[model samples]
Target: MDKKEELKRRQADIEAMGGPSRVERQHQMGKWSARERIQYLLDANTFEEIGAHVTHRGTRFGMDAVQAPADGVVTGFGRIEGRPVYIFAQDFTVLGGSLGEMHAAKIQRVQDLALKSGVPIIGLNDSGGARIQEGVDALNGYGEIFKRNTWASGVIPQITVIMGPSAGGAVYSPALTDVIIMVRHTAQMFITGPQVIQAVTGETVSAEDLGGADTHLKRSGVAHLAVDSDAEALDGVRRVLSFLPQNWMEEPPVVKSRDPLERIDETLARVVPDDANKPYDVAGIIGSILDEGDFFPLQKGYADNLVVGLGRIGGHPVGIVANQPRVLAGTLDINASDKLARFVRFADAFNIPIVTLVDTPGYLPGTSQEYGGIIRHGAKVLYAYAEATVPKVTLILRKAYGGAYLAMCSRSLGADLVLAWPTAEIAVMGPDGAANIIFRREIEGSDNPAETKAAKAEEYRQQFANPYVAAGHGYIDAVIEPEKTRGHLAQALMALYNKQDHRPKRHHGNIPV
Candidate 1:
């Protein structure tokens, strides 16, 4: 054959791996092929696909007769919103998108490019796990990809989009990434499928309930963002990337802020009701203080009590960890503790500053929490805060009690500046709870026990329910008015923009998992 005809024939063979039938079936299942996904995610005409002509090396079990397109994976470098990024999409239409030795090599090369170039890398995972024909080569392929995921972590941003089934050992690669975006009604991830569970444990459960978008987002907390469609998931990825820098060495990009830096929001004064029992959206305070009311909440469905996400303060990127009083009174439970710890570490790793908004009753005290290793999980948050060398600024919004107060980025945890509102009550416990123990004899001996107990509680509140006590001892740097929250935070962030902190020389700490 002539050179021109040979090139065309090879291109045709690459496109013919799954034929038209399999590609159409993938589309019918509401999933796009690997090429289509790359086209949608990256800028128009920017994707330079790599390894399109690579072939599988397996020859066992009639593998020689099998022609896998791009070895079931399409990898390339592209630009998203004018910023360079490396990406890979698994071609589920070809060999069920199973990973073989060459498929893994394609992904690892793009990942290496991303790391070397100091650019973000995204993986669009839609695989049915390892290829059976390749045996241990397939397993080794997964192991190689996972090593790259770990090596690239923190040094550069890593994101994963679960567009389809990611089962068996394949799910760990995404787990190692910084962010995960999954599509609803389609994306599913589990260590074992439902059939395996039925065969072993005999527990019957639907796939959706087992490892779907809802399951991971709301229950397992495995996915960072779970949207209705692949487009939405991709948009989520773009939004998150906008807040992060290309790498840890660089600062996060800052846009122009329409909201004035000195804007005082009086609404914050009235946002928190006097009735401590009443629930309020702490997100309101968060939105008001942030630039353009932007608060990108993470793990929103799971551990709703502790709200955490990346946001801009004075147009500068920051990680906001706030206590959501609307759920479980913003108490720190096991899941909430884990959420806070992981987020703090991520922000610190990426050179993003940390801002904590505190208003918690205390740790969630319950039999279930204790049984679920709340002590161990809660230690994770403490260790994260103490170990982080980033600029830490904490604001006490309402109640800060007991160890929970210390756990929520208090001064002892090395907060650069701990600011509190006038309404903040930094105490060992609530007034009523403390009054009961301290005045037990007085209440028990009094003829009017109820009235005496009420008076004692009232006395406790008057003395310790304000921020002045903590301010006097320097636990709180300043007790600012609610209206001045945005101004204070902006000033604080600017002053500490180039903060530096030291840590002992060590490879890495063994944090409580």
Candidate 2:
């Protein structure tokens, strides 16, 4: 037990407990080890792994027979695109990548580090739920992780990638994160597996059909983006991070650009429909106005009524949340509200300034919508927008009416700059709906009730529907030409690029339900 002999014995223990073997296994899996994944995800060779020597304490069930590197969960700090970020990647090969006591402790440690450092956290998840052998200890592991997620809410960005099978309670971590990315064939996520469902309901289903990229992206909207391969999935993560700041306290990175802010396109003049009832593609207008061409749409098919996308205005990445009047008359429903809320919170998390293009009639009015909790769902959109700390610029491309207007980044909700196009119509309600309510007495009193109602509606439209009234009342910041939208938004973003809001000695605000 001399000094020299003790040092040699420690070195031998490290080699015997899967040092080179774990490294080789990473190559065989056609993927990097948990540690290697952290290295590649971060700036080259910048990761400094913490708790690399921690291992399982269990010895009775031959647990000592296995060697755990980083406790099967690689936790560390590294630079992503030259900015510091905290990351964790679970090693699925190690004991099915279950969360044990040490593994959970490692995760919480890095999460606390991320909170202290005020940096974004990226989690590469590929686990088989909790470690059953640990029983209550495993549940406590998850409880600690959940506590970190709740504490980190609105303070830093949390990203989760489901690179492999993640079942049971493991799914909630990603559910609380800002974004979730899934690989097409490799990733599978669900609260419970199909076997459990079959046992409970006597209905059979496959895992892929139950929870795959197709199911998540199209049906559940659980995953924000899906890629065909692991490489693409990783690339998607980088692309998403590029638009975001390290945290809410910092401004999003701005790149030099040659695109002119005032560059006008002929399409902008004719993009909107002259008739109020007719529908036009909002995406077309967005595509035409954003920088040259850098529009990246998220959740495109799942919630068709609302359009959420990432794009560059003068080469500065911005989150674009617009209402698609073409679908369901651009009405806010439960699903669309949920989709918009998620996108808004995501943008706010990373300090990516938001640009909302509103063209909505109002919330969808129907028995199905009411029963499905439209009021609860619609409030999410308002809460998200109101709580957002990033600079928000909203444009009224066509119709902006009622509570929908407030939910869509109106001036009252702390919108830094609100612009309206000449064709915009800002009203308490659509003229037809207003006429039905206010002019009921006049219309019902007329000999020709139908003709009187129609005339009243037209009269109301001419008097109160135009953007001029909104601008005059200071409800809108500016009434710019349609072609000038790109420049106006870029300027507004630049003006508020250094904006910061610090609460008055408060740990956090009450996030509205």
Candidate 3:
């Protein structure tokens, strides 16, 4: 055969994927084909395919008669929004997108290129776990991929999109990535299937209930963002990358500011109510301060008491960690601690400045928290804040009490500039709790104990619970009005833009997991 004719045949073979019928099956399941997803995600004609003609050497089960196109995975480099990125999309049509020796090699090659180039790597996982027919070779493939995932972590951003079943060992790869975007109804991730669980533990739960996108997003905190379709999941990936830099060595991409830096919102003054116990949506405060009210929330469905996400203040990308008083009274719990610590670490690693909005009463107190190791978990927040070398600017919105105050990036935890609002109640604890202990004798011996207790609590609040007390000791750098929050943050972030911080020389601090 002529060389040109052979080239045409090979090109047609690769593009065909598993076959027309299998591709149709993928569409019927409400998911895009592997190539289709790539085409949609990347810029027009920007993808440069690598390892396109690779094939598996599996010689078990049906023996060597099987033909696998692209070894069940499409790997290449492309431009997403004009920025270069490495991507690998598993073709579920080919042998169920199962991982084999060559399949893993293709993914590893892309991972290596991404790490070396200092560009982000994205994995579109729609696999049916390892190719069991290939035995240990398939298992070794997973191990190789995991090693690269670990090596590339923090150096370059790694994102995963779970579009279909990612059960058993398949879930770990996505877990290792920086963010996991899952498609609802079609995607699921679990260590064990319902059949196995029912057989061993007698728990008869469906796949959706066990590892659906909502379960992971709201309960397990495994999935960062869950979308209704594959297109939205891909869009979520792009949105997340917009907030982060191409690599950890560089600062996050700064864009033109849409909102005026000097813009002040009078509504912010009323966002925090006069009553301390009243709940408020902290998203209001976040939206008002960010550029054009644009905030890309991370793990929004999980650990909602603590809100952490990426946003721009004056067009400079920054990480915002705020307390949501609407949930658990903004108190730190195990899940919230994990969420806060991870987000802070990600921001610090990527050279993004940290903006923490504090309003927690304190740590959530209960036997569940204690038995669940809240001390170890809570220490993660303190460790993350203290260990971060980025420019840390903390704002005390309302209640900042006890250890939670310190954990929320206080002046003591190496915050570069600490700002507080007039309504901020920065104290050891709430005034009522403190007054009861400090003035116990007077209150018990008083003619009207209730009246005396109220008077002492009021006195305590006036004397020590407010921001001025913290400002007096130089713990707070500035106490500004709530209306001036955006202006204050914009200026503070600008001033600290070139902020330099150094840590003690060590291999690495032992962060509590």
Candidate with better TM-score, 1 vs 2: 1
- What lDDT score belongs to each candidate, Candidate 1 first? 0.92, 0.83, 0.93
Model 1 lDDT tens row, 82-171: 999999999898999999999999999999999999999999999988999999999999999999999998899999999999999999
Q: In candidate 2, which residue ranges exceed 4 Å CA deviation? A: 1-36, 441-451, 498-508
Model 3, 1-513: lDDT tens per residue?
A: 999999889989989999999999999999999999999999899999999999988777784999898999999999988999999999999999999999999999999999999999999999999999888998999999999999988999999999999999888889999999999999999999999999999999999999999999999999999999989999998889988899988888888987999898999989998988799999999999999999999998999999999999988999999999999999999999999999999999899999999999999999999999999999999999999988899999999999999999999999999999999999999999999999999999999999999999999998987899899999999999899899999999999888778888997789999
Candidate 2 lDDT tens digits, 1-513: 899998677656533334667557655655555655665677898887777677777565567676665567777788878888888888876776789888999899989999998898989997888887767778898988988998887788888888878898898888888888887767789988999999999889888888987789888989888877666777777887887777767767877777788787778888898988899999888887677767888877777899998988887788999999889999999999999998898888777889999999999999999998888889999888988878898999999999998889999988989999898999999998899999999999999999999999999999988999989989898988887777777788889878886445676556545
TM-score of 3: 0.99
Answer with 2 or 3, whichever has the higher lDDT. Answer: 3
Residue 151's lDDT within candidate 3 is 91
TM-score of each: 0.98, 0.89, 0.99
What's the C-alpha lDDT at position 137 in model 3?
91
Q: Output the TM-score of candidate 1.
A: 0.98
Model 3, residue 194: distance off in Å is: 0.9
The model with the greatest TM-score is 3
